[model samples]
Target: FASGVDFHSATAVDMFPHVRAAVDSGEVLLEWDGKNGTPPKPLVKDKYASERRKAKTLNFSIVYGKTVQGLSKDWGVSLGEAQELLDKWYSARPEVLEWQ
Candidate 1:
């Protein structure tokens, strides 16, 4: 990551090879520090939680570039239901919605 190799250009599946190779070759090490550092909390609890939930909900939308019908088929829900969820997700994360 520090090597300035931007992995964001790679697809989700495409990056797996490098990650797997790193672990398989023991090039990666995992350790936990015993420091009791306080984890910074969210600035807006309710809205942040909502945004997080919405972001998760929209992951499928982005990953699949789903249409209402496509989301309906994938989630086994009606098109209207999928659209409603998608709408809520967009409302919660307008920037993400704007990107799409």
Candidate 2:
């Protein structure tokens, strides 16, 4: 059960603190479904909610080796917007970018 737990253990131990600090300082908000009673509530409403969601989708797509043109079509954003979003994400998560 819960495969990949070992694979991610190092990241959980090392990088989670940084992520938690960002959440605590209001620099980022964590959101998830509450159906399972875990992460039972939404974080603060972001003013740029739509843009953030698009950026998040692009981030995940990048992790899966998606190209910019594919991400543009998948997110229904222009190529420029997708590229900009990716740039911002890479800047924000340089460590993750390096690992990728």
Candidate 3:
């Protein structure tokens, strides 16, 4: 990882306090509400501890060169929704995309 972050039990999103805060606060819009399709809505908080899984999926997904279609399938969402999430995540962490 560009940040060189490591974890033992939980994903970085759940393991790191700052990462958890960022995710919970919508600093990283990984947690989304898929029920609303017209305009995918982003959930500001990971009330059910979903952000950790999303962050973990994104980290490995990005490294593996996953496509928007792949993300769409992986997250059970539409391509546009997946692309939107990737755009937001990349916008929030340009350094990660730059490193890639």
Question: Evaluated with TM-score, which candidate comes out highest?
Answer: 3
Model 2 accuracy (lDDT, Cα): 0.53
lDDT: worst 10-residue window of model 1: 6-15
Give the worst 10-residue stretch by lDDT in candidate 2: 5-14
TM agreement with the true structure for every prediction = 0.42, 0.47, 0.52
Give the range where candidate 3 is weakest over 10 consecutive residues by summed lDDT: 1-10
- Per-residue lDDT of candidate 2, residues 1-100 (tens digit): 1342221222222224554455567664454345667453334223334444544455567789887788678868899976765675566557776777
The lDDT of each candidate is 0.46, 0.53, 0.61
Ranking by TM-score: 3, 2, 1
- Name the lDDT value of residue 11 in candidate 3: 56
lDDT of 3 by residue, 4-100 (tens): 3432113545434676676577565434335656324333334334555666677678778999999999889999998987786676567777788
Candidate 2: list runs displaced more than 4 Å: 1-42, 45-56
TM-score of 2: 0.47
lDDT of 2 at 93: 58
Kindly indicate the candidate among 2 and 3 with the higher lDDT.
3
Instruction: Give candidate 1 misplaced runs (Cα > 4 Å).
Output: 1-58
> Which of candidates 2 and 3 is the stronger one according to TM-score?
3
lDDT score for candidate 3 against the true structure: 0.61
